[model samples]
Target: MNEKFTGIVLFIRPHREKDSLVKIFTREFGTKMFFVRGLQSPNHPLKKHLIPLTEHRYWGTINQQGLSFLKEGQTHNLFRSIQSDPFKQAHAAYLSQLVDASIDDNSEDQQLFDIFEAALCSLNEREDARPIQLLLQLKLLRRFGLRLNMNSCVVCGSSQKIEDFSMTHLGVLCHNHLDTDPNRMRLSYKQIKILQLFNEIKLNQLGHVSISDQSYKRIDELIFMIYHEQVGIKLKGESYLNQLYKVADQLKVSKIEGT
Candidate 1:
C-alpha cells in the first residue's frame, strides 16, 4: 500500500531510457532514492514536483533499503525564485549537495530537516542569502561530529579577548595565546564578530543580514579552509560555487575601478 510522505528533492538523474532516479530527503525516512518511472517523458505528472531543491508530498513505497517507488507527487514549495535565478540556483545546488553528502542513508534527523527547509525558504525570500548559507554550514558541522570553538581560545580555553583564529586548532585564539600556534591567522574584530553571529543566527526567523562584502569574503575564506581540511568531501557544486564567486568578486572590482 502506498502512503503519503514529505520530502525535499535533492537531485534527479536519468536512470535508463525513459526512467529517472531521484534522491529526496524525506522527513520520515531521511535521505531516500526513489525510482521514478517514465520521468523523462513530457507528460509525467510528478515531473514538476520532482525538480531538484523543491519540496513535495508524494505517495510512495517506503523501503528499509534500496530504491523506493513513487506513484504520485504534489508540489509543496517549488522555490520559484531559486528556480528562476542563476545565482540562487548555484547556492541551492551547493547547499543541498552539502547536506546530502554529510548525512548517512536512512538516518533520521528532524533538526537537519528543519534547517534545510528553513534554508530553502530563506534563500527564496532574501536577495543576499549567503549569510544564511554560512549559518547552515556552521550548524551542519556538528552533524559531522566537528565543532569550531568560537567562544574561547582553543589553547588556553579562555573566553576573554579573542583576537585571532588558528586553522591548526580549528578555533579562535585569545590575545594571550595567539602565539601558541605558529600557523594562527590574523583576523579583524569584524571577521571574528561575523563568525559568532553566524553561530547565533536563527534560520527560521532570519532577517536581512547586513554584512560588508569584505567581511563576508574573509569569513567565507575561513569556513572554506575549515571544510577543506576537515570535511574533505569534494562536492560537484563546490567547484562551480568557487568559480562563480571568484567571477563575482572580479566584477565588483571592475565596477569599483570604473567608478
Candidate 2:
C-alpha cells in the first residue's frame, strides 16, 4: 500500500551492502524505519531528499510491525540555511537527537510533532540558533518526565520571593526554602526571568529571541544541570557542538593575540 506522509530524516545507517535504513519521524506515524534498496548506488534519485535534517513528503509502504519501505519522495523543505551553516546544522542535529530519544516508535504525538516542526522552521529562519535550541530543550523536558518547577518553590510550593534554583529539589526555591537544599543554585534576577521565558516560549510565534551573553551562559548552566542530574541523556550532537565551540573560541583567541 502506497501512502504519502511528511517526515524528517532523523538519521541514516548502512544496511546489507549498498542498501540503507532511514529513521524518519513522521507527522502521521511517530517514528519508523524505512529500508531503501541501492541507496548508495552511484545515481540514486532519492539521495538528495534522504539527507539528515531534511524533511520530505514520502510515498512509502506503511508497516505496523516491522521495517517499512520507501518508493519515492519529494523535498518538503531543503532547510537550505541550516544546510549552509555549521552552527545551525549542529543545533538541528542536537534537536533531532533529543526528539528521537524522547519519543517511542510508531507513537503519534501531535503536540510533540507540531513543536518540533516549528523549532526546525524557526532554526532555519533565524540567524541565532541558540535561542531556538534553548526553547526546544526546555520544552522537551516535560516529555522526558523531568519537568522543573518554574512557577514556585518545589519544596513549599510558594510562588513569592523565589530566590534560587535547587538542583536537589529539581526546581525553584523560595528564600525561606533555600536551606532545604544546601546545594541550591543562586540565580540572578535576569537569569530567573530568562529561565521562565525559555520554559514558556512559543515556537511558532517566536519574536526577538534575545538574551545577554552573561544570562545566556547562566541559563545553559541551569538547563544542563537538569539534564545531567535528572535526564542523564548524552548525545553525539551535543558532544560535537561542544568541540566546535572550543575550536571557535581558540580561533578567536589566536586572532586577538596576533593583532
- TM-scores, all candidates, are 0.94, 0.94
Candidate 1, clashing residue pairs? none
Which regions of candidate 1 are displaced past 4 Å? 253-259
lDDT of 1 by residue, 1-259 (tens): 4768899999998988999999999988899998988999998988888999999999989888788889888889999999998788888999999899888988877778888998999899889768777988898888778888899889889988999888988899998888888887677988898887777667765666688877877787888777888888677786888799899889999999999
Candidate 1 overall Cα lDDT vs. reference?
Answer: 0.86
Instruction: Give the per-residue Cα lDDT of candidate 1 at 244.
Output: 90
What C-alpha lDDT does candidate 2 achieve relative to the native structure? 0.86
Each prediction's Cα lDDT score? 0.86, 0.86
Q: Candidate 2: how many backbone clashes?
A: 0
Residues 115-230, candidate 2: write the lDDT tens digits: 88888888899999999988889888988898878889888888898888888877888889889887777888678777777787677656885687667667777777777778
Candidate 2 ranges beyond 4 A from true positions: none
Q: Mind sharing the TM-score for model 2?
A: 0.94
